[model samples]
Target: MLYISSNLRSLRSKRNLSQLAVSDAMKFGLDQYKKYEYGKNTPPAESLLVISRFYHISIDLLLTVDLEKVSIGDLVTLENNRIVLPITVDCNGNNLVEVVTQKAKAGYAAGGYTDFSFISELDHISLPWLDKNEKHRVFPLDGDSMPPHNDKSSIIGKYIDKLGDVVDGKTYIIITKNNEMVYKRLNRNGKNTFSLTSDNSFYNSYEINFSDIAEIWEYAGSLEREQFKPETNDINNLTMVIKKIERDMVEIKAKMA
Candidate 1:
């Protein structure tokens, strides 16, 4: 969703700056500035760059994040400015993790960064054992590539604000700018990119550039939607071995007789 229009208005108002003053400073005509603020028109790439530098905020954030709901100062301070998480808190001030449902997973990579209301509409639950101070969210597992965490389970993730902060070999819920989310173990390739490998070896490892990333969420914990499945292979193998031993003993007795 486009938010630059509302963001322009919010940023200007928050700094106690008048529209006329901002228009003059931005070298934008008064009417043009009004049109941008009112969502009548979107700014071109050149204008976006100027606005981004002027506001000291990334263009991705300016165009996506709702500045009205988040503090511009905090958003600017975060590394990469990947996303403004609409993390909610409980009455006791504990962080309540928003659970992204199975259906919502598809849209999350898009709305999770762009729309504040979209996130708020998601169901939330509190995991008190975790550090109450950190931002976290719940995402449903999509494919079997990450074993033991198929569509039948969900993973709780701790938000990683910057791509560089990711630890090698650690699992993370990575959201790509192409609007795809996948869980994988990351290995930094020393080329501003990551080699994402799946737990299930059937899936080949792939390299993804830092620019392709939209958000990073380090794996915190997991919730199993299905019960543990017991394998009978070992039990059947043991039974077959015992029966073979008995047949061998009987054959020796028959030869002696």
Candidate 2:
């Protein structure tokens, strides 16, 4: 309830709405609404519901989250007080997506992901095709663990706050607290862990505890940079296999001798 007063004031101020105007919109008495803003009295649950609906924010968020510390975007629907990522837009009102590339992943995992200043300072790009209502980010991947996504190609993901919404066997960008950033297909390993498997069979699957995860972004789309001319060197692959077989035969002969 401590954040309620400041949140009320902050929301109103951001919209440039007068107290009377807000009160009239919510059908709340001006004095009562003023009391709520001034922290003189806490609104009843019903009144809070009215305000919540009017603001299009969850009651839990209104009562708990410090609005001043966060930049609110009406785009993301807040459910059960889940963190609403600050959504920024360009001058033309197109949503600006902040990118977290392979090089900056360590910094991002080291609190830059949650720090407002750090997020704002990162590079941004605008893509109009994505749903404007959802929060999105672009992550450029480099590894061959997930094939078909050309190395260094970028993937756009929608931010999902609740872990419950993470469906099994879906690809996602998982950021762990241990400063690890990886994109892999996921499954429910248990009540508190996620089983991650790479699309490429060369990489082994592993499980990550729920407690270790910092953020999970659902795969939305990709910006795959098509390789103009691919190197087709099957002879090298055959040579390696032949060498491996020759080494195995030599080891067997040595053992027999």
Candidate 3:
């Protein structure tokens, strides 16, 4: 009952290819390929593999998913039993890093990240330091929860496809199911949760369930809106100076004693 005839037809149409053209590329008789589009017959496994390779799509997706409704990013393919990302590349042969601004943050958290139209509408930049093969996205920071990356700044995050790749004590931009987007230093709490901590001690740390995390982007680099000033009146800065002074006085007292 799960026929791939429609899916095949949709993909071909999307690519603006005629049935005859596809059949010629596949080296199959025109009549035989027509049967596949007409829902009278299905392609063999070998033929399916050929089609998948030609279209740069996965066989599982070709057979199971509605290609018309799914975006390229949402498609997952298995190579050697490992999942592969369908990263989009620009015509200039450069990988595009999509920027998630404060205005678009809500849409991204609400599952718009995987929508082709939504993603296309977002502004993109190319980073020379970033590998063309790696998937990346940029997110804007809103609060002073983390120093060095204060309000009006943005962090470029490399897409973390698997949860097991998350490193302890590293910073990440976490997107939650309820649209809670935050940048925090991460620590593994257990198998299913992570301890999220802000650099500023004033904000208490807490644990977040992995199930609530919709997406995770590992911190790669940052862009500051304004020139960084070391003399900012942050409470953490004053606290650190006071603590250093107190430690120095204690050392002097111990030496005298």
lDDT of 3 by residue, 13-65 (tens): 98899988999998989999999888899899888778877776756556655
TM-score per model over all chains: 0.61, 0.60, 0.61
- lDDT of all predictions: 0.79, 0.77, 0.77
Q: Write the per-residue lDDT of candidate 1 for residues 1-257, one digit (tens) a residue.
A: 77899999888988899999999999999999899999999999888877876787766567765767765454423335443345555554455799999888888877465566677688988787888657789888877778767888898999886665789999999888888888999999977789999976656689988878777889999999788566437886587578767877887999999
Off by over 4 Å in 3: 1-87, 231-257
Candidate 2, poorest ten consecutive residues by summed lDDT? 75-84
Tens digits of per-residue lDDT, candidate 2, 1-257, equal 35788999999998899999999999988999999999999989889778777887756568766777756565233233323344455654445789877677678877577555567777898787888756799888867778778565888988886778899889998877787778899999877788999986546689988877877899999887785345437995577567767877887999999
Candidate ranking under lDDT, highest first, comes to 1, 3, 2
Q: Which runs in model 1 stand beyond 4 Å of their true positions?
A: 1-83, 230-257
180 in model 2: Cα distance from truth in Å? 0.7
